[model samples]
Target: MAVERNIKCVVAYDGTKYQGWQRLKNSDHTIQGKIEHVLSKMTNEKIEVMGSGRTDAGVHARWQVFNFHTRCQKSTKNMMDYMNQYLPEDIGVCQVEDVDLRFHSRFHAKKKTYIYRIWIGEYPPVFERKYVHVVTETLHLQKMKEAALLFIGEHDFQGFCSRKVKKSTVRKINHVQLKQEGHELTISVTGNGFLYNMVRIMVGTLIDIGKGTLTKETITEALDTKDRSKAGERAPAKGLILHDVSY
Candidate 1:
């Protein structure tokens, strides 16, 4: 008998082509759907892969975790190799490990970090166009940094999310930071969890502040009043990358 075993996988993908991480009922062109289809074909049985969380369309991921129960007899290395060989070139299985049956990727996740990249040069980047958000205006790094600090700590982020949320908007932001190297600025945020478009909206607001379009009061009012309109623009999805999910 083929014994059921739990398998954990670390996935990395360039989200430029697909419709994000989750499966949509209407379309099968999704990351999860692609992986599931391949696995099901290889195993000759229906297979479902669960991810830590969903990444919005056009958002990339460096380390997304997922787990599933399988009866495939391939060794861990062979499993990883099989996925890499069959999966699309944009998505790759970084590693595969056998885990306890109780390991649930989403429920057991500890924290997730996301990074947004912005290009400050006037001329558009030639090669990195799809991977970064290019800002033509001069940005006030100090002002943006100050405003980003306010996002640190727990607060109600009702205004930060874009979806029709039924759950509480309160979430903890463990850290907020910005690092500039030449014309590229990387905005990194780590938190217990994130609302739909939370990171993208935050980045947009920060960019507005950097450009002197938005003020400190804007961030404060959004948090205090829980008004979505009080927040800044939601940054483009391509600039956001799932840095990692820590468990």
Candidate 2:
């Protein structure tokens, strides 16, 4: 009898066309569903791939970690090659390894970094339109930086999350870095875990601050009151990318 093995894989995808990362009952156009379909055929068993977390529709991922258990004896290299050969062109398998049976992709994840790109140029970024959010308003980067700093510590971000859940809304953010190069404004957030739409809301609030539409005190009030209405609107999903996942 073949031993069951935990197969870990890192994947990247241009999620422009898919219905997010999680599998759905009615839709076949999902990143997880596509990968799982290929794996099930490769392993000759019902394979269910577990992702580190779910990314909403139209959100891209540069590095997403996932794992599945299988009894197939194919080598890791062969498995990676087989998956890439069958998976769609938009989704690429970056790395594959045989992990311990106890290891889990979502449960063992220590940190995740998401990058939200904004184009603050006067002209349209034709080449990067799908990857960036174009903003025409005059933005104050210094003000945005000051507002981003307030999100570094742990807080009950009930105001930032759009979905109401029974779980605790308190989460610790390791860092929030904002960098501007020419017309590109990149906001990178590193956190242990994120709530639904939390990152987008944080970025949106910063953009509001940059435009002088919202004051920095809004962050304090939002954190204190845990009111969703206190935060800014959720940013577009296209601008958000799952940049990296750390074990």
Candidate 3:
């Protein structure tokens, strides 16, 4: 029997055209599906790759990680080249390596960092409209920063999540950093794990707080009451990016 080797890969993709990261049964319009198609062609086997996590539709990823087991004899470098050659131009393979057979990308991930970019420029972001959320209102960074502090550390993030959780809603947020440069405002968050739409909802709440529509007390209310309605609107998916995943 040919030995099956675990192959790990890092990929970056513009998720504008794809549905999401996870593969769907009826549809092939996903990042995972596209890569799997190319990989299967190369290996001559039906391959299923395990992703570190899913990114929602219209959400981009700069350093998404996934792993799969394959019996193909190609070197890691050749596999990477083959994937890039066949995969859509929107998706790019950054690295490929042979890893331990037991290595599972999703379970092995220890931390993930996500970044949401907002443009507060006077004019619309004509050059980068697809990549950022453009906001015309003045956003008070100080207020947003103060409100952001409330999210750090462990908490039952049920209120921040948009979906009902069958599992525990508790998640640990390591840090929330906000930076502004000219017309750009970036909200970067590092967390152990996140509930569905948690980061986007948090960003939306922060934006509302900055605009004086919501107060810092709103975060406390969400944490204390576990009411999703207490949180702000979920931010648009275009602004969100999976920045990195660390094992």
Of the candidates numbered 1 and 3, which has the greater lDDT value? 3
Return the TM-score for each candidate structure. 0.98, 0.99, 0.99
Provide backbone clash counts, one per model: 0, 0, 0
Residues 43-115 of candidate 1 have per-residue lDDT tens digits of 7879999899999989999999999898988899988888899999999999899999899999999999999
Query: Which should have the higher TM-score, number 1 or number 2?
Result: 2
So what's the TM-score on candidate 3?
0.99
> Which runs in model 1 stand beyond 4 Å of their true positions?
none
Segments of candidate 2 deviating more than 4 angstroms: none
Q: What do the candidate models score in CA lDDT, each in turn?
A: 0.92, 0.95, 0.95
lDDT by residue for model 3 (113-190), tens: 999999996899988798899999999999999999999999999999999989999999999999999899999999
